[model samples]
Target: MSRAKSPFSPAAVLRGALVPMLVVALWQGLSMSGLINPVVLPSPVAVVERWWAYLLPPDPYDPAQGSWFLWALSGEMLFDAWSSLYRVVLGFAVGAGLALPLGLAMGGKPRIYALMDPLLQILRPIPPIAYIPLAILWFGLGNAPAVFLIAIGAFFPVLMNTIAGVRHVDGIYLRAARNLGVGRTTMFIRVILPAATPYILAGARIGIGTAFIVVIVSEMIAVNSGLGFRILEAREFMWSDKIIAGMFTIGLLGLAIDIGMNRLNNHLLRWHRGLEN
Candidate 1:
């Protein structure tokens, strides 16, 4: 069951902020106190300042010599984030689309499941990063390889979860449908699909996370643009602040995405009692 709702509670927000604010305060104290080298571990504020440079337009009076550079830097952050997001959506959609039907068929029929299980077993264990070299060679860098890598990474979670969800449907449902003379297509549309929705959504959520992980890896090596590439570029310059900023930016985006997915899942599975937390 869910927890009881509280009236507009600043206390709840403060509770959530307690640890993070403490950590930030400690980090700032250590950096400013010179107890920790900023080069080794930049303070959160320093990292945020670096991100601001990459995200904000230049001050108009700062000098034309500097304004162009600031604008370009800001554009770089926007472009990289957009590129990565684009790849994640494309790859996740493609992979999930391909997974659903195959998984449904596999879960519904023993023979079909047997035939597909071997291939799934063989490929499922391999990390998407393992395919990078071949992906680069085959797709030859840029978004193609990154997209392919993301797709491969996102695929299995969805497939496996879909199959599991389908399998989880009560046998009584199937027997009842058959006794009612429901045809195969009608039964699948009215019964199987609804029963498997939760599993499919769970798999999609996992797939989204996987897509993000694989996209970063793919971007680091296969492509020249994205937050992953920005981090690598910062490393080349020995810009610890920028590197950490890029990392935090990626983490923040991933967290936002995960929250969005969790909300969507709860909405879709509102009737599913086991999902309540």
Candidate 2:
């Protein structure tokens, strides 16, 4: 007799893939049936064709020397995508690095919380977009300002979560550690940090997602060489296909980053297994 396949089999993968295929098929079918305007909602095939033309530009079809064509370097959407990605990573890292330590300090001591809570309340309410004018005045336009915005965007979620996590660490665990004559440093490193790992991962996940939004907005305002800028440029030229492509690229990148972070989260919090399941 044939053995039954495992739950994690390739068959499960095929089942997951079917939903998107069906959705794409429906979209393409609607366009082909004239239910959707080719101008307003171009078929997937048209988008793919335009994407092809945009990427692999060819010799002039018309003899005009200065005919409008995609820019050889800046026009490649992938370059812009990479540029935005680099800034997001840098900014998100800065936010997390600073937030975690500050959060720990506040959570570990009442005095620190009294000093920092009011500032967090005032700043957290201010949306990243609202700060664009000030950020521009402070840092000027370019990657520096864009990264600053992303850092600002990512900082709060991590900071707030980390503080809560550290504070809520099991009191019993701390008592147990103290009974064992653990030093303050050993108590924090050995008892508190591990207990707060789940919350830290949760905060990191949220921060990464928030960073994606901030990075895009920052790029639109401050940077001239990222996916957001490409989207703006495509709109100016009325290249809807490229515009959609850039938006899709940003979304795909965000989803991929989130998935990777979740995997990391799961690995770090394995002891808390089935909590999220």
Candidate 3:
């Protein structure tokens, strides 16, 4: 039997690293060649150095120097990261919590679909960023507005995916369940939900990416602390290295979240994979 390839294998690791390594090399070359102004776009090395300094603990030897580092740190990188993470989690939870049930109901019942679909269709096309002013007005300048924006970003993707998943459940499964005299609740719980899980998960993955994007945008305006806020603050000061560091931090965090979501998807869809195999 052929063994499953491990992502951690050296070959896989090398393949993954090649493009990123090449890009960095090109970036460094451009920086060194003085084609681009350092003030406009800092070198990757400078960004890395800034990130390292941002992560370091304050020096105890000279409190004044430590204060300078602390000021530059802007409440520490980890704290800002955690703040962004918390908003994403909370907002995503609220969005998914509402969307899942509503989607299921709409998908299962034509009446529900007819009643809601028109309004949802109209609203879905509106960008989450468009809601920023209203969100701030409604929730004021704090976590509330950021969370609201993130929820708005997450809601539509999840809702659409869930509805599609449920609607697309194979007709054969419904026939089989009905043939067995299964009640509506049992049929839905045992057959429809399982069949739709993969689609729901797919939607969730998309929603999470949207959540991250919305959270960052919201943080830039709605809240005073987060990676987005840091990036914006750096921009105001013309600190290109710090801005790049913050951008990289957000990228790394998004990568971590995507990896986690993939693991969850694998765990949940093992049965589906077995059937396909």
Give the Cα lDDT of each candidate.
0.87, 0.82, 0.91
Clashing residue pair totals per candidate (backbone < 3 A): 0, 0, 0
List, residue by residue over 1-277, the lDDT tens digit for candidate 1. 5674653478777787899999999888889998887788888888998988876654443455666655555556777888889999999888888898899999888899999899889999999889999999999978998988899888999999999988899989999999999999988888998889998998999999999999888888988899999999899988999998888889988998899999999998898878865
Stretches of candidate 2 off by over 4 Å are 1-15, 33-37, 52-75, 275-277
Instruction: For candidate 3, write residues 51-161 as lDDT tens digits.
Output: 998766544345555566455444478888989999999999999999999999999999999999999999999999999999988999999999988998899999999
Which of 1 and 3 is the better model by lDDT? 3
Assess the local accuracy of residue 3 in candidate 1 as a C-alpha lDDT between 0 and 100. 73
Off by over 4 Å in 3: 1-15, 59-75, 274-277
Whole-model alpha-carbon lDDT for candidate 3: 0.91
TM-score of 2: 0.84
Cα error, candidate 1, residue 194 (Å): 1.2
Between prediction 1 and prediction 2, which has the larger lDDT? Answer: 1
114-163: candidate 2 lDDT, tens digit per residue: 99999889999888778889989999988888888888888888998899
Q: Number of the top candidate by TM-score?
A: 1
State candidate 1's TM-score.
0.89
